[model samples]
Target chain A: MDLHVEGVKKVYGDGPTARLALDETSFTVESGQFISIVGPSGCGKSTLLMMMAGLLKPTAGGIRLGSTPISGPPPGVAVVFQDYGRSLFPWMTVGKNLSMAAAADKLPKAEVARRVDEALTAVDLAGTQALYPWQMSGGMQQRVAIARALVVEPTVMLMDEPLAAVDAQTRADLEDLVLALRDRYDMTVAMVTHDIDEAVYVADRVIVLAAHPGRLIADIPVDLGRRDQLTTKAEPEFVKRRAEVFTLVRRPAATSSAGSDAELDGRPSELKA
Target chain B: MPDPSGATSTLTSAPPPPPAGDKAPTTRVPRRKRPFGRRLVSGVSSLWLLVAIAILWQVVATLSPTLYFPPLSKIFVQFGQDWFTGDPSSLFLSQHFFDAALPSLRRLAQGWGLALVVGIPVGILLGRSAVAAAMYFPFIRFWLAEPKSAIIPVAVQIFGIADSMNVFLIFVGTVGLIIVNTADGVAGVDRMTLQTARSLRISPFTLYRRVLVPAAMPGILTGVRVSIGVALILMVISELYATTAGVGYEILLNQQSFKFLQMWSAFLLIGVISVLLNVVLELIEKRVLRWQRREGLSGQ
Candidate 1:
C-alpha cells in the first residue's frame, strides 16, 4: 500500500505562543520506495515520521495508508525509533520484544514464535532470541530494533534517525544492513536522518526538508544501480547529491507559510533579511 | 532465515554460531562468573564492616561492660535460647518465634502486600491523569512528609488494639512511598518507548501490561525497595503502639522487665530479618528484570 501525506499542517500551540511545526506537507511514497528525509534539526522530520506512523495527529489535513485515512496507529506500518536503548522494554528478552509486534495480531503461539525467529534471523541476529537487548552492543541493539519492525511484516517501515546514537563504524555497518533489510523484506522505508552522505548512500529518493516551519524543498533521486560502503560513496553522482542536499539544508528555507515569523522577529532590525 | 534472499548475509558480518561455552564472539563482552569459592568470598567481603562492628561491640562489652551496653555474647545466647527452644514438631523454633516473629511477619506481609497491590494501580492512575494527580498529589505529599507515627492514633481509634490496627498503620505508613515512586516511574517512561508502543498499535490493556508496566518497573521496584525499609520500621513502630504478641512487643516486655539482654537479642533479630527481607526483594527484582542484569544469564 502507498502512503500519502496530504497537505498536512501541524501547529504546536494557540495564541501568541503558537509555533508552526510543519506546513502543508504533501507527498506520496510509492510502494517499495526507499525515501530518506534529510534536514537540519528543526525540520520537523521526526514529527512528520511520527504522523506517518499514525502516532501523532496532524492539526490539518490527514495521512492515509492505501485509501484509509489514519485516525489511529495504521495497520500495516511499523516504526524504529532513534533511541534504541530506551525504545525497547528493558524488562523483556530479545525474543519477547519481537513477539510483542505480533501480540495484538492474535497470531497463534507457534506463529508468533516463528515470526520472531524469522525476523531476528532476517537481521542476522539469529540465536540471539534469548539475550536481553541492552546486553548487546549499540549496533546489535539497533539490529534488534530493525528486526522488531520486520516482525510486524509491515508494508511501510518508518525509522526516526535510527542510526543516530551509534558509533561511526557501527553506523556505517547499520546503513548497509538497512539497505539489505529493505531489499530482503521488500518493504517501503522512509528514514528520517540528518547525515547527508548516509541519506544519499542508502535512499533511492532523498527528500530534502527545510526548517522554520518545515516544508519539503526538493525531492532528488539517486539512480545509483548498486551500492557499496566503500566505492559507492566515492561515486561522482553520490558526491553531487550529498552536496546538493547539504546546501538545501544549510540555505535556510525561503518560505515560512505558517505566518509565524518568530525566527526573523527575534532578529535585530539590520539582520532581518 | 527462511528468506531466499539470505544472500544479503554478506552485507553485515555474520553473528557467530551461538557459543557452546560461556561467552559470545562479539566484542569482548564482560562476564561476571568466577570460581565458586572466590565468588562467595567476594560477596561476603562486603559484609566485613558488619562483622568488624559486631566484633568491636563484643570486645568492648566483655572487657568493660556498661549497664546500658550489655555484653554482645550474652545477647547472642539469649537470642539462641529464645528463638531455638521450640519442640521438635515446631522445627526447634521457640514460643517467641511463633508468637512474636510469626505475627510480625504475617502483619508485615498483609500490610505491605496490600500497599503494593493497591498502591501500584492507584499510582499508575494518578500518573495517567493530570486532574487526578492535581487533586491527590498534594494530599499524598502532605501525608508522606508528616511522620507516619502521627497517624497511629487515628488507626488505633478505628481498629482499636486489633491486628487491623497494626495492619492499618503499616499500610498507611508505606503505601505513600509506593504510590509516589510508581507514579513517578510511570511518568518517567521513555518518550520513545511510548511512541514505539503507539506505532505498534498495542491495545490499551496490552500496552499497560507489556510496555508501561515494564518501563515503570524499575521505579516501582525502587519504591518497593525503599518501602521494605519503611515497612520494617513501620511494622515495629506499629507493634510498639499496641500489640499483644509481636517481635516489637517482645522488645517492649523485655525492656519493661529490665531483661536488657533479651531486648538486645530481639533487636538483633529485627536487623537479621531486615537484611533477609532486602535479599528476598532483590532476588525477586532481579528475576523480574533479568534484562537489566548481565551476570546471571543462565536461566530464562
Candidate 2:
C-alpha cells in the first residue's frame, strides 16, 4: 500500500513544559518503494516511524494509507522494532513468534502454519522452529523479528533502526537479507537509521531529516544503478550521495528560528515530491 | 514474478546460508542427557557436603550426650521404631504414621493449593489493572507484613481448633506473599514485549494468557517456593494448639513425658520433611523454568 504523511506535528507536553518532537513533516511512500529516513541523534526519526505504524499518534495533522487516514495500526501493516531482544517474546520459540503475528491477525490455524513456514524460509531461517529467540545470536534474533513481520504479508513494513544492535559483519549480512526480502515480497519498507551509507545503499530514496523538532531537510533519490556490499558502496554515485547526506546531517542549526525555517523550506519544491 | 513497481531491480545472488554454529550451544541445555558417568560424578560432588554435615552431627552428639540432645543412633532407632514398623498390608506404614504424618501432609497440601488458586488470578488482576492495583496494593502489603501467628487465636475462636483452623492459618500465611510476587512479575514484563503484543492487536485475554502469565512465571514460581516455607511454618504453629494428630503434637507429647530421645526424633522428622519439601519445589522450579536457565538469563 502507498503511505502518505501529511503535515504532522508532535509535542510532548502542554504549555511551557512542552517540547516539539517533530515539526510539520510531510512525505509520501509509493507502493513497493524502499524509503529510509536518516537523521542525527534526537532527530525524531523513530517518532515519525512510530506515527506511520499507528503506534503513536501525531499531535496535529494525520497519516493516511491509500486515501484512508489511519487512527490505529491499519490492516496489512507490520512493524520491525529496533530492540529485537525486547521486541521478540523470550519464552516463545522462533516459529511460535511468527505464528503469534499470524494468529493475532486472526488468520486460520492451517494458513498460519503455512505462512509461518513460508516466512521463515524467506528469511533463510527454515527449520529454526523450536529454538527460543534468546537461544540465538543477536543477528539471528533480528532475523526472527524480520520473519515475524513478513509472516503477516504486510503491505507496509516499518522498521525502527532494525540493524543498530548487531555487529558490523552480521549487520552487512542482515542488510543484504532485508534487501532480498523486500524484492521477494515486494514490500513497501520505511526504515529509520543513523547510518548514512546504509540509508543510501538500500533505499530507493533517502529522506534526510534535520534535528531540533525534526523537519525534512532534503529528499535525495538514490539512482545508483547497482547495489552490492562489496562494489556498490565503492561506486562514485554512492560516495557522492553519502557525502551529500552527511553534509546535510552535520550542518549546524541556525540559532535564529527564521533562519532554520528558511533553510528547511528553501529546498527545491520538486524534491519534496 | 511481475515487477510490481516497474523498477528493473534484479536480485543479487542469494544471501549466504544462515550460520550453523548459532544452533550448537543451545542443544547442551538438556542436562538429563549427560552420560551416566558424568551424572554420577556431579551427583557425588553435590552430596559430599551433606554427608560431611551428617557425620559432624553424629560426632558432636556422641561426644556430648544430653537428655535433650540424644545420640544420633538412639534417635534413629526411635524414628525407625515409631515410623518404619507397621502393618505390612498398608504400605508398611505404622498407625502412628497415619495419625501424625498423614494429617500434616494433607493440611499442607490443602492450604498451599488453596493459596495458589486464590493468589494467582488476584495477583494478575492487581498487576495488570491500575485501578485494581491502586485499590488493593496497600491493603495487601499491610496484611502480608502482619504475622499469621497473631491471627491464629481469632481463627481458633471461629473454627474451634478443627482442621479448618489449621487450613485458615496456612492460607493466611501464604496467600499474601504469592499475590505480591505474582503482581510484581506481571508488572515486570518488558515494556517492548507488551508493545509488540499491542501492535499485533491481540485480544486482551490472549495477551494475559500467552504473554503476561508466562513472562511472570519465574517470579510466581519463586513466590511458590517461598510460600512453601511459610506454609510449613504455619502448619507447625497451628498444630501446636488443641491439635491431637500432627508432628507438632507428637513433639509436645514426648516433651511432657520426658522422652527426650522421642522428642529429638520428632524434630529430626520435621527437619527431614522440610528438606524434602524444598527438594520437591526445586524440582518443579527446574522443570518450569527450563527456558530461563537454557537462555542463560537468570536462575543462576
**Residue B160 in candidate 1 has what lDDT?**
90
Residue range A144-245, candidate 2, lDDT tens digits: 899999988988899999999988888887888888888788899999999998999999999988777677888899987646788999888899999999
- TM-score, candidate 2, is 0.88
- Residue B46 CA displacement from its true place in model 2, Å: 5.4
lDDT of 1 by residue, B1-300 (tens): 233235334434332222233222243346657899997898789989989998999899989988667878788898899899989998998886887899999999999999999999999998778899999999999999999888888888998998998888888888999999999999888887888788777899999988888888989999999988988998999888788988999899888998898888889889889999999999999888766664433222
Per-residue C-alpha lDDT of model 2 across residues B1-300, encoded as one tens digit per residue: 222121113334466544555432334245448898998999999999988887887888899876777777788899988887897888777888888888998998899999999999999888888899999999999999898899989999999979988988899899999999999999898989888987887888899888999999998997899999999999988888768789888888899999988888788788899999999989988877766744352211
What interface RMSD does each of the candidate structures achieve?
Answer: 6.4, 6.8
TM-scores, one per candidate: 0.87, 0.88
lDDT, each prediction: 0.82, 0.83
> Which residue pairs in model 2 clash with each other?
none
Model 1 stretches with alpha carbons more than 4 Å out: A234-240, A255-273, B1-30, B33-70, B294-300
lDDT of 1 by residue, A95-179 (tens): 8999998887888999889888778777666667777776676677888899999887888999999999887877876787777
